[model samples]
Target chain A: MDTAMLIEKSALVLLLFLISLGVAAYQTYFERKLAAWIQDRVGPDRAGPFGILQPIADGTKMFLKEDFIPAKADKWLFIIGPGISMFTALITSSVIPWGTNLNLFGRDISLQVADFNIGILFVFGVVSIGVYGIMIGGWASNNKYSLYGAIRASSQMISYELAMGISAITIVMLTGSLSLNDIVKSQHGMNWNIFYQPLAFFIFFITSLAELNRAPFDLPECESELIGGYHTEYSSMKLGLYLFSEYTSMFVSSAIMAVMFFGGYNVPGMDAFSGNILAILSIAAFALKIFLIIFVIMWIRWTIPRFRFDQLMHLGWKVLIPVAIVNMLITGLVVAWNQGWM
Target chain B: MSLQMISVILGSLTIASGLMVVLSKHPIRSVIYLVITFFFISAMYILMNAQFLAIVNMIVYAGAIMVLFLFVLMLLNLNKEMEPETTRMSLFTAVIAGGTLFLVMITALRDTFQYGKGYVQVPVQDAGLVEQLGKLLFSKYLVPFEISSILFIAAMVGAVLLAKREKQIID
Candidate 1:
């Protein structure tokens, strides 16, 4: 690659990494505020200007707190666990197309980092590896609650992944290419995948919730029984890393949902604009979609109760998988029919 | 030249981690080593521009299968004290089996080197891309692909059957 391209990519990567971290930090604040609003109580107003500075305060507190490890905890794995969690969480954002191309310095700069041919699969691969974080953390802690939580997490993720992949396959089939940019381009001018494949979108949305370990599917860290679940023995920034990774994954998943089911950055009559204005507006539009999705996710988290472990497993295996497969078959028939395969 | 250097580096790392999988005393550690080996192997695939295969390899082996292996090992809690003593007969059988496998690998390597370049290379351009792979799978290798999918389904059914508990008739 040329020096300019290399520099562009590195800059984009750095920018994306910072954006993910920033979004995650603020997601925690929004989550608390939303939860408080849902429960009819005043949320944090002590921090600067409507508690906008709360995330910073929380972050500083996490850093300054005692970084404790249990006596029986496996030292290296304990450290590696949260690192893996945070790493996997952050890296999945690389493939998502955040906006349209911008023309700068006689060059067209794409807003995506690496537009790999197998972009969606890359996300899937990272997500599958995400389980190791909780598993290793729980196992390393040598605590029963942690182990139980880890086991629950791995099983839940594995079970939901089958349905999730199947649901995503419908979109892949529709797009006829694995590239996220292609998927977004195909949905130009408000022809979102959600309109055509609502069932698939439903399955994908539910499965994403399961994959993110958010309520009402959060059986892994059910506090009433497991007491903070996998991170029960964790403290300080070690705990902070785990929580941060969760919100980061939430951000990434919301982005994926927006890109896939929503029209990504494509608004009706968006073709009217061109160049830098287009790129900036598209980025703003994409960001708006992502925030809306995040709001709905948090709304569900506060509104719905956690599922029973068996109920979660049942929904994943018996309900979601079958529905996804049938939806995929119907989509296949439609695609084939459209292509004169009948 | 740099691609070759990267391939060589990844190849050696894969072998080293593969060796550690067997050499590690702890089962969980062995699984971790196996995952490392898988990562190196997938990196090699990426180096070859086999992006589709690389990610699928990651999703399947390092992601799904190894997670289950780690899960089982963690639950088993098999420490040194819990490890069963290796019998003489078992050791003898293991040695013989390992020796036979080594001989087979040696023969395979010898034949590969004799008939072709010392290193393997994918002959077709963009053969590792999803589009090319999909076309090839549907056209040239359709029967084998179908048969393998069938075999997978059979294996999945067998697993479910094995795991299902028989219903009890309570007196």
Candidate 2:
């Protein structure tokens, strides 16, 4: 509204974007290290200590390489595909409550970029469009495998989104609000929604894995079948953006899970500690929760193998959606019973 | 003044993109332009404080429906431009239909609005919110909602059945 307010909001927006990028960058490093540890081998020790700077090296290589577009490809669309992926991935985190409000210089600073009313819907909406990146990218490549990969990717999204949306309905039903901030606030100390909606949490977690294209659900990029998948024709930084956006979406989904179910920024007896001190500590708590979730995601990636395409579809449509619906009905009944309506 | 200016920009972009949707030779390009137009329309909805409608528009139309369109278009393998030659009768019919639609739209706009007051000054309180919408639907529009869902289920079942290849029936 005012100049100071504009500046503060802009600052928060920039800070959030940088944090997403930074975390996504480090995620690559961490995933590789974790994968190596899973296989009982030392990995990427050349760049920095224990390959900590491996991501930086990989990034530089991507940037300095020759950018090539296939001769028959739609040039503009090819370029914009990864851009769309990166943009959507980065923007989805804007509504996630990073921490509580802070008091500084006689001004209260909200940690989130912008706390929209329908925060969960905003994430879902952006996430649904994420498939366009893979779809258009593969189509623009003019390669058959790329097209097949894109088709698989989009169909997979279309299938899982039903279960994902239904699962979120249970959350929204339990919280009685669509805003992530309200969702987080409702879980003050130990009253997280996961305690009440365990089934929804499980359904949501699996859908999130499929949504992020992490291992066990990475059907679109199944290397055995479709080599390089959607980005088979893409080279240089464009491919890098595709890879980076995956990790970014992974981090964002992890953050979303942390906020929605894991009591984001809320520690036990956190209400007792008030003021800026509490706010700072809450931020740390939120980050720690996010990192733990991301670690678990990587663990899942390495430990479990990918599912067959039919099995993936069956799980999403038959198992998860029905379970989510039953979960929602039971949650509604419980809430009604609590309110003496039953 | 600022809101009106932003609306004007968004409105022009929507129209331009809509035009591009038709004018683009490639079907995929048309789909992309339509998606762009939808985004602009969603932005206008947000400007009107209809955040739920805005995000739902993005989710349903730009996200899900457009992806379906892309999949179908790609499957048809119609990537090359279609060069349809316009005949005299066809051109005349097109012009007549376009003229009639344009006149109807202009008349409707002129009849419905009192210039700026109609769209800007009047605020729609809680109209676009989920809770308000849900309560209204469940109360006043319950029958229609249920019926529509049943209709969707029917259509889905019909599609699945129709998609299956038939086996010969032995009488």
Candidate 3:
């Protein structure tokens, strides 16, 4: 690899890291603001102009507060849990294409950190590893509540992931490629996959909510029964890490949903724009779509209540999985028919 | 140089974690070590240009199976196993069994590594891709592929049958 390529990749990685952190921080503020708005109450406004700086203040408090560890807790695992959560959440961005490649210094520069051929598979694998953080942290806390939350979180994620993968298979079958870039590129003009695979998109949306532990699928850390769920024993920045990872996952999942379903970086008259202008506009368009999806996720969180554990499991397996399988078969037939194979 | 260095690191870590899985007294610790071992194996698969296998290894084994292992271990509540009294006879038996297993593994691996052409290092181009693998599996290995699907169906039915309530089973 040339120095310029290495530097470019590193720069993209760094940029993504900063963007994820910033989004996560602001996500907390937005969630609270939205929550208050829904409830007809004023949210934090003292910090900086309608609580713009609230996240910074909240972050400072998390860092300054005393880091607490339970006497019976396993020290090493407890410490490692939140770190793993944040790490997996952030690294997922590496495979996600931010926008089309841009030309700079007479060279083609990719916007993504790493454009692996198995980008979607990489995402699935990384998402699966995220369960370890919650499970380990919960187990380490030596709290019954924590353990219960951890178990719930692990089971729920695994259950939903199957449906999620099956639903995504329809898209993969439609596109005939696993690379996110290829998936996005195939949807040029007004030919988005969501229009073609609406059922798959529905399943994906619900599964994404479950995967992120957002309500009504947020049984992992349901405050009513599990008392903060897996992060019950976490305090200070450790707790912050857990919360930060949640929003980071939210951001990542929103991006995935937008890219897969909502014609990522696409606009109606995008073809009319010149090449370089289109690239810049695409990035902006991608960001706008991501935030819009993020807003919808938070809207659901406030609008809906948490599902009972059994109800969550039943929805995931009995309902979604079967529906996803049927969708997959339908997609396969359609693709085959379109290709004149049948 | 960097690639080789990464390989060396992953290789040693894999062996170490594999050893830890057996040596650790805590089952959860062992499971963690086993997961680490699986991750290193996946990394090695990536090194060999088997990216599909690498990701699948992580997804299936490290991600899914290991989480189940962890869940079961947590439910059992076995933080530490009761240390079996180390009798001299048992120690001697263990040493003999361990030595024999080690020797067998080493001999088998040695032959496997150099048998067909002294460790062919050429990476198969796009051999690990989904399209390439799918074509080969659906055409060349169609029978086995279909058989595996049938096997999976049988296994699923068996699982459901076994998990039925005792009253249901008796009925």
Candidate 4:
């Protein structure tokens, strides 16, 4: 690679890393503000112009707090726990195609950090690895409640992941390629996959929510029963990392949902835009879709109560998995018929 | 000296972790080591230009199967104190067995190797591995695929039966 290309890619990676951290931090503030609004109260309006600086305040609080390691905890594993959570959450975005290639200084630069052909599968693999952070953190905490929470989180994520994978399979069958960019391209103009594969979309949407362990599927961190759940013993920035990773996964999931189903960055009349304006418009379109999805997630979090553990497992195995498989079969048949292979 | 040397270094780390899987005292630690081993294997698969297989390896082995093993280990409470120290003779026997296995693998690999002949460079295609695997499953390997389904069904039934606890008759 040329020096400029190397520098560009490095800059892109750094930008994405910073953006993800900022998004995660602000997502926490957003959730709090939304929760406040829902409950008919003013959120952190005092913290720098309608709580724009709330995330900064939160960060300061977490950093200044005393870092406490539990006496019974495994120190090395404890440190590694949050590190794994944050790393996995951050790295999963590398394969996601944020927008089409942008031309800069006579070089075409892809918005994504990496574009592996098996992008969707890479996502599934990375998401599964994310379970280790919670599991290890819980195990290292040496608290029974944390251990229980960890087990719940692991099993729940694993079960929901199968349904999530199957849902992605339906999309793959429709698109005929595993690359996220190809999937996005296939959904150009009004040709979004959601129109043809609504069932698959619903299954994927719900399963993604479950996979992220947001409200109604947030059994792992159910405060009523498990007493702060997996990260009960974690204090200061270690705790912040766990919480930040949760919101980061939510943001990433929202972005994935938007890109996969909502015709990512593809406005209805986007073809009419010219030159630099087109690029900026497309990026704005993508950002808007992502924010909308994130808002919907926050809405659901405030709307629904957590499910019972057994009920959560039943939804994954008996309901979502079967629905996902049926969607896949139907999608496959449709694709085959359209291609005259049937 | 190049990316190949970096891969070689990674491969050695993987092999070391794989060895640690058996050598570790705690079962949980062994499971962790095995997970790391799977990760290393996945990295090697990436090096071999099999990104799909590498991701699948991580998803299935390091992610799903290892999580199950960890769950079982945790459920059984097989932590540090539960691990028993190996006797000298058992250790000697393990070493012998490991040595024999290594020798057999090396010899077999050496004997089966064909160097710098009948190798053709083909243009890389973007046909997702899943698509090719699906085609193979439905065509050339249909019978084996069907048989595997039967095996899976049997395994499911066996699992349900095994998990069903016996109830006492109330008088």
Candidate 5:
């Protein structure tokens, strides 16, 4: 590859890494503030300038703290646990499309790290691998609570992931493409799939939340039952990696939802602009949509009470999976009819 | 030299781990080793230019199947003490079976193996397998698919019947 292309690829990777890290950091602060606002209380105003530096302070605290490994814990596996969690979280975002292609220095550049044709499937594969992180971490901790949490997490994720995959199948049928960029392009203008496949959208959105272990569906880490769940024994930056990965995955999921269903980067009259300003504006619009989606997730977390474990299982198997399957069938029928293949 | 050497190394790792999976006393540890075996097998698949199969192998076998194994192990509460020791005769039979299998595989490889004859590099078609697999599944494999659904329903019913609690009658 040419130097310029190599440079661009490296820059893209670096940019995505920084964006995920930054968003994950702020999401922690954002969740707290949202929770406080919903409960009618002041939140985090001491750190610097309206507590804008709170994440920094939190990072410092985690870093400066003493890292502890339990005496009975498998030290290598314990270390691998957080490493796997953080790695899977970051790698899953590689296939997500951030914006349309931009022309820079006489070369066209796509606003994605990779544009694999099986992008959606890749995401599913990576997300499935994510369970191993929790399972290993919990198992290696050598605590009963941790082990229970791990088992719960593995089962929960496996169950919810089926619904998520089926929901994605609906979109794949509608778009006739698995690439995230292609899906975004298909949803260009005012033709968002959300309008056509609202049921699928809802299933995908809810399942995405569950997959991220967000509130209401956060049974894996349900403090009331499992005592902080999977990461109960984790401390210092090991715990921070777990928490950061959760929020990062949340941020990436929000972005995926926006790109897949919300006409990503395509505002009304977006075609009217041309040149550098338009590119910048489009990227800004995409970022705004992602941020709004993240805010809505946090809002849901603060509003909804956690579900009973049995209720969560019932919703997954008896409700979401069947609904998703039906939606996929409908989508396939619609696509076939549209293509005159009936 | 390079491709052959890499394949040999990966193949050895895969076979060794596959053996470890069966030989390991601890069920949980066996599952872990089996996962590693799946990973090595996937790597071998990738080396053979079967990217789709490699990914599916990792996802279905290593990721999902082994997680199920680990989950079952955890649920059963089976640890080292719970596992039964193999009798000397059983161990001997297992070793003989393993040795015979290895010998057969080596002999088969010696007869069938060929290098660099018709190695055509096919263009990587994006979503090719997914599209073809979807067509084959919905059309040619429809009967099997429907049968599988019926099987799943039967299993669900069986599980419910087995797990249902019975209440004692008051005299």
Candidate 6:
């Protein structure tokens, strides 16, 4: 790669990193505020206007708190646990096609960091590895509750991942490509995958919720049952990293859902504009969709009660997996028919 | 600086981690090292421009399978005190097995070196791409692929059957 291209990609990477972190930080504030509003109470009103600065305050507290390690904890692994969590969470966004190309300084710059051929697979791989962060943290903590949480997290992620993969395969069949950019491009001009593959979208959405460990599936860190779950023994910035990674993964998964089912950065009448203005508008549209999805996720979190472990397993294995497989078979048949194969 | 240099570095690291996998005293640490070894092997696959292979390796081996391995090991909670005593008989058997495998590999690899074909080239530039791989699998390797898939199904069914039997016994 040329130096200029290298610089451009680095700049884009930095921009995405900042955007994800910023959105995740704000998500914490919004989650609490929404929860309070749902409960008919004012939340964090003491921290700036409408509690806008609450995340900052919480972050500072996390930084200032004692960085505690349990006496029996595996020291190096304990430290590496949260680091891995944050690393995996942030890197999953690398494959996301944020917007169309921007014409800047007489150069066409793609908004994505790396448009790998196996884009969706890359996301799955990162997410699969994401289990390690929780596993290591909980196991290294040497606590019974933490170990239970770790086990639950691993099995849950593994189970739901199968359904998620099958669901995504339906989209892959329809789009005939694994790259997220191509998937988004295929869905241009209101021809979103959700229109054709609603069942796949539903399955994917539910699986993403489970994958993100959001409520109804947040058994790993369920407060009442597991006492903060895998992160029970984590303190200070270590705990903050775990929490921050959750929000980051949430934002990334939301973006993935948007790109896969929704029309990504594609907006109605997008052809009306051209050049950098179009790129900016597309990005804005993508951001708006992502926020809408995130809001829905938060809404579900507040509205639904946590599922029991058996119920969660049943939903993933018995229900989602079979349904997703059937959906994929139907989608494949339809696509094959369209291709004149049957 | 070059791809070769990077590959060399990765190869060495992979070996080191692979060694650690067997050398680590703690079973959990060994599993973690095995994961690290899988990651290095995946990286090597990337160096070979086999992105699909690299990612599948990561997902299946490092991600899913290794996590299960780690889970079982963690559940067992095998510490220093619980480690099995290494008797001379078991040690001798392990050495014999390891040495026999080493000898077989050395003999197997010697033919390629003798033929001066130790360095093989990827026949197609995009051989490892998903499209090319899929086409090849469906066309050329279809029967073997189908057979392996059937084998996998059999394994999965057997596991489920075993679990169900155990549950019935408990009831």
Candidates' chain A TM-scores:
0.99, 0.98, 0.98, 0.98, 0.98, 0.99
Alpha-carbon runs more than 4 Å astray in model 5: B1-27, B44-49, B77-79, B114-128, B132-171
> Poorest 10 consecutive residues of model 2 chain B by lDDT?
B162-171
Q: Candidate 3 on A1-342: residue-level lDDT in tens?
A: 889989888888888999999999999999999999999999989998898999999999999999999999989899999999999999998887888778888888878787789899999999999999999999999999999999999999999999999999998888889998888888886789889999999999999999888987988898988889999999999999999999999999889887888877776688888667888998999999999989988999889887888888889999999999998998898889999999
Report the Cα lDDT for candidate 4: 0.86
Worst 10 residues of 5 chain A by lDDT: A273-282
lDDT of 6 by residue, A1-342 (tens): 999999999999898899899999999999999999999999888888887899999999999999999999999899999999999999988899999899989999999989999999999999999999999999999999999999999999999999999999998998899999999999987889999999998999999999888997999998898898999999999999999999999999999999999989999899999999999999999999999999999999999999999999999999999999999898888889999998
What docking grade applies to model 2? Answer: high
Better of 1 and 3 by TM-score: 1
Q: Pull out the clashing pairs in model 6.
A: none
Candidate 6 docking class = high
Candidate 1 per-residue C-alpha lDDT over A165-202 given as tens digits, one digit per residue, 9 for 90 to 100: 99999999999989999999999988999999899889
lDDT of 1 by residue, B27-106 (tens): 88899999989999899888777989999999999999999999999999989898889999999999999999999999
Clashing pairs in 5: none
Measured over all alpha carbons after superposition, the RMSD of each candidate to the real structure, in angstroms, is 1.4, 2.2, 1.9, 2.9, 3.4, 1.4
Per-residue lDDT of model 4, residues A20-120, tens digit only: 99999999889999999999999888789998999999999999999999897878888999999999888877877777668778877878888777888
Q: Positional deviation of B122 in candidate 5, in angstroms?
A: 6.5
Q: Per-residue lDDT of B126-148 in model 6, one digit per residue for the tens? A: 78999999999999999999999
Q: How big is the positional error of residue B161 in model 4, measured in Å on the Cα after superposition?
A: 3.8
Model 4 stretches with alpha carbons more than 4 Å out = B1-4, B84-103, B109-146, B164-171
Candidate 1 residue runs with Cα over 4 Å from true position: B120-122, B168-171
- For model 2 the local lDDT of residue B46 reads 84
For each prediction in turn, the share of the native Cα contacts (below 8 Å between chains A and B) that it retains comes to: 0.92, 0.92, 0.88, 0.81, 0.42, 0.92
Fnat measured on candidate 3:
0.88
Task: Supply DockQ values for each candidate.
Answer: 0.94, 0.88, 0.91, 0.80, 0.55, 0.94
Q: lDDT scores for all predictions? A: 0.93, 0.89, 0.90, 0.86, 0.85, 0.93
